[model samples]
Target: MAFALPVWLAVQEELLAYGGEVDPESPSCFDDFDDEALFQMFHLTRPCIAFITDSTRIRMKKVALKKPTLPVDAMVMVTLNYYAHGVSSAAIQQRLRLSQNDCLSIICTVSGVIAGMADQFISFPLTRAARTNVALKIEKLCGITDALGVLAAAHFKIRASPYEKDTFRSFVNTLGYTSVVSQFICDSDGNILSVEKCCVGSTFEQDLWESSFKGREMEDELHGQYWVIGGSSYNLSKHVLTPVSEPANEKENRFNQAHAKIHDVMRITLGSMKRRFRCLMQLGFAQEGSLDKKSNIIKACSVLHNISKKFSVPPPPVVGKIEPLHPGRQHSVPIQINPEALKARQELIDCNFSVASSRQDPPSETVTEEDL
Candidate 1:
C-alpha cells in the first residue's frame, strides 16, 4: 500500500513554496518594474510609492504580529494594487503568495494608515488669505472671480447589502445598480479640498449637502467674502452660486459659460480619482463592517489621489464620458431663490462675466469642452 503524506507536511510544503516565490526580507522585487509598469500596475510612480511606504511604515510595524512579516514596501504594493484594481481578494492572495488572512489584514491596515493622513492631505481654505489664494487660482483658470471652489456628487457602485437595501438602491430607473453617493469639493487645479461621508445613492445631492457639517455652516463661514459654486440642484445662498435657469440676455449666457468652466474642475477631480483608484468605480468592500469603514476606504483613496497630484502623476486616459459627479437622473427643478443670493449672483455676472467684462479682461486660460 502507498503511504500518504501527513497534513502537516503538506502545509509545510505550501509554506516553503510561498517563501521561495516571495522573499519577505527583500522588497526589491518591485525594482523589476519600470516607471510605466509601476503606474500601470499600482497607479503610482516609484517615488510616490516610496513616499507612502515611508509615511505609513511606523504605524504598520506597530500592528504587525504574525511571522513572515511582509516588508513595508511589499505591504504597500499589495494594498495599492488592491485599490487600483477592484479584483477579488483571492486574486491578490494568489498573485502575492499570501494567505487569505494576511492579504485582508494588509489591506485593512494600510487603508487605515492612509486614511489617517486625511487631515494633512485634505483641507479647505477657511482663512481670508487662504480663501483669496484659492479664488485667485479659480479666476486664473476660468475667470470666475471670487469663486473659492466647486461642489458635486458621484455615485459609487457597491454590492447589494441586507442593511438599508432600499436606501442603497439607485432611485432612478435608468441606473439599476446599488451604490452610495459621495460629495466632493475641489479647487481650480482639480485638487480635492473636502469629501463628505458616503450616503445612500437614493439621497439627493442637495439633501446630502444640507445634512453635512460644512454645508450647515458655509454661509456663516464665508461671511459674504467668497462664494462656492454648485449645480442648480443646490439651494442658492449668499455664499453659494448656481447657474441661471434661462438666459434672458448675452450677459446671462456669458455667466453660464464661465460657471461651467469652474464646474469642470470638480468633474475632472472626480474623474481622475476614479480612474486612478478604480475601487471607487465599483467599491469591493465587505458589507459586514460598519458603513463608516467603507466610507473611510473611499476617503483613503482620495488621500492617495491627492498625493499622486503632489507627485505630478499624470491621470490615466479617459475611456469615455467623464463619469458624471452630479447623480440626479433628471434636471433639477428650479427652487425659490434667496433674494440676497439672487442679487449677489446678478452683481457677480454684471461685474465679472458680462460681455463687456469679457472683452476688457479675457480669461487667462480658455478651457475647451473637449479638454474636460
Candidate 2:
C-alpha cells in the first residue's frame, strides 16, 4: 500500500508547484511593517529593500534553477534577516517556510551578489581634486584642515574550529577572542571611504595599515597634502596624524581635542554599522562554512551599511559590546614613533591652533559708526 507523504514534504511540494510568489505590498508581507518595524525586522526600510531586489533581480535570476525558488524579494529578506539578527539558517527556516538548505543557499547567493556591489557605495577619493573635495568637506564639518578621514580598526569575533588554529587564534587582540580585523577610513560625516578586511585577528593594526594599498598611496602620492587622523597605536607618518602622546601646553591640548573629533566620527560609524547589522557583532557559521565565507558575509554587510546610511535608515536599539570568548589574554604592541612627523604636527598646530592665530584681533579696537 502507498503511504501518504509527510505534512512538511507535502507543503514543500505544493509550494514548488506554485512557483513561489511573495506579495510585496500585502498586509502579511514585509510591506505591512511600518518603517521602524521593518527596520527592526530587516535593518532596512521597504523602499530600500525594494531597491536592493530590483538591482539584484537580473543576476539572481541568472543563477541556475535546480529547483523552484522564492521570489527575489523573499530571498533578499531572508539574507537581510540573517544579517540583522545573526541567526542561523535553521532559525529562519520555518518562518520563511523553506528548508534550512534553501535558506542557507539563498543567504550565500544573495550575500555574494550584494558584496559585488561594493564599488558602487564604497570608494576612496583617488584623484587630487577628489581628495581635496573630501578634505574640504571634513574641514567644514570638524574644523580639521586638510583632514581626509579617520583611520580605525574594528574586531568581529568568530568561532574557533579544530582546524586553522594559528590563523583564528585570539592571542593578538586585547579582548582575547578569535576575530577578523577590519580597518576602515571614514570621512567627517561617518561615511566609509575605504575598508580592508583581509587580515585576521592576530595581525597587528599597524601592519594592516602598512600593507594596505590606500595606506601606501597616502604615504607616497598624497603625503603632505592630506592626512587621516588615527589613534596613538598607529604609526605616525606624514599622512597620519596621531594625538600628542603628552600634551605639553594649551595649544597642544587644544590640538589633541580637535584631532579627537575625527576619531569620534569613526567610532560612531563603526558602532552604527554594528548596530544595524548585528551579525558583525558576533558572526555565526555552519560547520561547512570557512573563514572566506565569513569574510564575504562581512563584506556584504559593509555594503549594506553604506546603503542604509545613504537612505537615512534608523539605527536599531543599542546593544552592549560582544563578550570576549577568551578574556584575560591581552596583548599590546609598541608604536614606532617618527620624530620627523612630530615637526609636521607641530607646524600644523602653530599655524591653525596657536593662541595668537586663534584669537580675534581684539574685535577691532576702533569700532565703526555702524557698531556704535
Candidate 3:
C-alpha cells in the first residue's frame, strides 16, 4: 500500500527542518516516522518523481540546443530607443546586459533588412488613370482650379537644386520606379498632382517666376528681375524689384536693397550646394572631376546666365573683387568682363555712337556746288 502522506510535508521535513525552524504540531514533525518510513513514503510516489525529472531534463536540453537567434527584435528596440531618447549605446548595453559587438551586429543586420524591404516595396510608374484621379483629388483639397500650380510652388523650395534632381533619379533607378521627378507637381493643397517629367525643373526659382508671369494677365506689371554675378567661392545671383507706384528716385534705392538680399541668399545656397556635392562625390555618386576654383567660377557664371535667361533678366557682371590690404595701395581691382557683359557693353557703345551721328546729321546739312 502506498504511504498516505503529502509531498509538501516530506519536502518541508527534509529541507526546512534543517534550518532549525519547524512546528511541532505539523505532520512533518512526527517523531514516530524514521528515515526508512519517510523514504518509503516518498518512494510510493514514483510517477510524480519521474514526471518532475523528465520535465527538468527536457528544459535543460532545450536550453543547450536552442540557437541564438541574434535577438533581432531586441536590437531594433534598443537602437530605436537610443535614437529617440538620445541614450548612449553603452548605457543601453549595461541595462540590457548585452555586449557591444552583439548590439552593433543586431543593429546593422536589422537596418540592412529594413533597407532591403523598403527597396522592394516601393513600386513606380503609376497608371495614367491613377495620376488623373490623384490630380482631381488634389484640386478638391486645395480648392484651386490650377492645383498643379500650387503643387509646383510647394515643391519649388525643396527640389530647386541639381543635387535633389540627382538624388531622385538615383532613388527611382534603384527601385525600378518609372515616375520622373518632373512629372510630380505640387497642387494648391500641397498634394503631388499628376506625374509628368516636365515638373522636374518647375521648382527652380527662375522657372516658377517665368511660369507665374506668363500665366498672369500682365507680364509687364511684374517688378522683379534677377541676375548672376561673381565667380566660384564668391558666386552669387542678384535680384532687383521696383514697385510700380514708387518714384523714379526710389527705384534705384529699392534695387540696391533687393540686390543685396539676393546676393546674400545666393551665396549661402551655393556654398551649401558645393559642400553637399563634395560629400556626394566622395560617396561615389559624383565623378571626381576638376572642381578647382576656376571651374567653380565658370560653373557659377553659367548657372547665373541660365537663370537670368529663364527669368528674362539681364545677366549681371561676373566680376571678381580684389581688395587692397594696405590703405596706401591702390583701390580694389575690377576683374575682366564676362562674355555676356562684354557683348552688352559693345551694344551700348554702338547705340550711343549712332545717336550722336544722328543728332549731328539730322538732314540739316546740304552740300552746295563749290565751283558756282
lDDT of 2 by residue, 155-214 (tens): 777766647555445423666666777778877666678877655566667777888877
lDDT of each: 0.70, 0.67, 0.28
lDDT of 3 by residue, 115-169 (tens): 2221112212135453354335432321111112221111111111236556454
TM-score between candidate 3 and the true structure: 0.24
Which regions in candidate 3 have their CA more than 4 angstroms from the true location? 1-69, 86-91, 120-125, 143-372
Window of ten residues with lowest summed lDDT in model 2: 363-372
Over 4 Å off, model 1: 1-29, 58-69, 88-96, 161-176, 222-224, 285-289, 327-334, 356-372
For each candidate, give its TM-score against the true structure: 0.80, 0.77, 0.24
Candidate 1 scores a C-alpha RMSD against the true structure in Å of: 11.2
Write one digit per residue (lDDT tens) for candidate 1, span 1-372: 001124223433544544422233455646868988888888888867765665555434444535437776777778888788765346546767998668767877778777876776787887778788889878776667787789877778777655655543443222666667777888877777888868666667778777876676686664346788888767778877888989899888877877877886777778788888887787754342356766877889888887777777777777888766553543367677789889988998887766545333353455533343
Q: Give residue 138's lDDT in candidate 2 (0 to 100).
A: 65
Pairs in clash, predicted candidate 3: 150-187, 151-186, 151-187, 152-186, 182-196, 182-197, 182-199, 182-200, 183-196, 232-297
